[model samples]
Target chain A: MLKNLLLNRNLTCLFFILIISSFEKIHAQNAQVINFNSLQKIYSNKSDTTYFIHFFASWCLPCLNELPDFVSFSDQHKNEKVKMIFVSLDMKKDSIKTLPQLIEKFKINVPVFLLDETNADKWINMVDKKWSGSIPATLILNNEKKYKKFFSESMSLQTLNKLVK
Target chain B: MIKNIFDFSLLVAICVLSLGFSIKGNKSSYDFHLKNVGGNFVSLKDYPSAKGFIIVFTCNHCPFAKLYPERLNGLNSKYKNLGVPLIAICSSDTITYAEDSFLKMIEKAKNENFNFPYLCDGEQLAAKNFGAQKTPHAFILWKEKNNWTIKYSGAIDDNGAEPDKVQHHYVSDAVDELLKSKKVSIPETKSIGCQIHFRK
Candidate 1:
């Protein structure tokens, strides 16, 4: 009986380890690193669904303050045709650690992506000519409706709801 | 009733002040009398022998601005004798970012051993006048007919993360061209950094 109990305890430990590792894997897999081309593809998709792309950085205080609202908005509209995506503009050197840490800390369940590109001058105009390369900026795009709007400031949940539809 | 009148007068004063400095290049000259980190008020007019100025909008809290201190120091040393002294201003809203408070700015300047004068735009008047959008935003103003003309505006260099890999020295190159009486080849550029939000 003693031998059986010891084996069972070891097996339980192994099972817990597996669960934790897979949990981490899922967390990491949720956020992907994408280039500007991939971002263009995402915005260019001509579908009935509206895509809300929020551009932010870990170091930007205002962006952090508004993240939870965006996440909650995404949660409330999970079944709707509105798709929320977060794209981080954090520096490449620190994004690997900081991006995931921010994701986990914020309990953000929506799909996240790290924008992997340099020379913002080249692509910033492409994203939005009005965007002054500021954080907490959001882009709402729906190719089917031919509707696009960009805001370079932190927004409220009420504002998000009003604008998404 | 008296408070409302006072508010209206204040708004009028702000409008008049903002109109003094135009964002467009060669439109108007801008002047600022801001407090320096050295516990004294300094202005562009203080430098009587200056040919122009390199005014940078920066703050202590922004990580991107932190990376450019050494580069700014280098630029100041390289161009100070050339009659274009570099002046850095911290115009970040202290209410939002305590790290960017005037006291913290003094501490940062001291800790960094900054050779150039770090000024405080307490009201963010200078930032609004220059239409500065982000931290580490650079502007090169040249002395033309006794007025400061904005010849170049934008990032300090091409690379913010890796200074060694910098391909274009936008600010300095503009300064060099201005000194030689030539037009700036690349007058404007954009950078990725923390935005400077206006105080409510």
Candidate 2:
């Protein structure tokens, strides 16, 4: 009977440890706030790697809807030298908490960076001249190796596949 | 004498380059015959009685746009009789964002009780012509002798998240200056908004 009680206690402790670990996994992925210069540095650092950069804001409903699509696309292209990074336009102070929550909710492990610049016009044209300072914009670059493309809208799975290649 | 001429030529080139950079490219407003939610066709030239019009590129689903339904209503009610009525256009591509389709726009207008004509830019021609980057973008046009000329372009206010937190009333201020026969002090201001999804 003593042995049975000890086994039951051990099982309860194991269950609690599992629950704590899962919680930490869900909540621990924090987003870093990056300025325009830093953002440029990141892309410029790896010229040979294909980069699929997505810009989104927390309040944008269309952005929220397409995020899962972006995650899935990144998953399929993980081994293809394509690096997908989500740059959020959400305020750094608020997004630190919300972004990870969203990542967990979507069940997608992805790199998210909060764009810290408030002067949107400064970087909007830098991203693409055709971009009129809009959210849910995606910019794809193969650096100096290939061509770069910018799309200023929410894209579907088919459109995403077509544009990435 | 040669050095003086060279300096003058360089100065002219500098001035030209500065001028080119300062003024953003301007495309004359496109002619649109869009249907309002009431199934009424709204043409820019239809408001002959008004001295000017407030053309707002807005949609139903954008969160920032949603914050200003009451404010827009207030603007229409307060300013329509003042000769600057509001004309809102939804230019999102209907195929991707079905909530912004013509029928959905009608239901939303009914629900919001939008007093102004909420027109649907089915082909997004109006948005393209106006260079509207996002939803809730406003362009103020004043009747200039024979034709309407765009005078002010940008956000309605500084805060789209909360009305009470507004610091700048860009549309109201511009309209006020126009009413007083004065140039708008701040002609343009950038706004935070959802990008208008255009079809490829």
lDDT of each: 0.89, 0.82
What are the per-model numbers of colliding residue pairs?
0, 0
Model 2 has a DockQ score of 0.22
lDDT of 2 by residue, B123-180 (tens): 8888988888788899998988767888998888876655686767889999999999
Put down candidate 1 lDDT per residue, B2-36, tens digits, no spaces.
99999999999998777764445323547899999
lDDT per residue, candidate 2, A1-165, as tens digits?
999999999999999999998886656454667898898877765467888888887767788888888888989888887788888887555676677777777766667788877555457778887776677889888876866888877887778888766
What docking grade applies to model 1? Answer: medium
Candidate with best TM-score: 1
User: What local lDDT score does residue B13 receive in model 1, on the 0 to 100 scale?
Assistant: 94
The C-alpha RMSD of each candidate to the native structure, in angstroms, is 6.1, 12.2
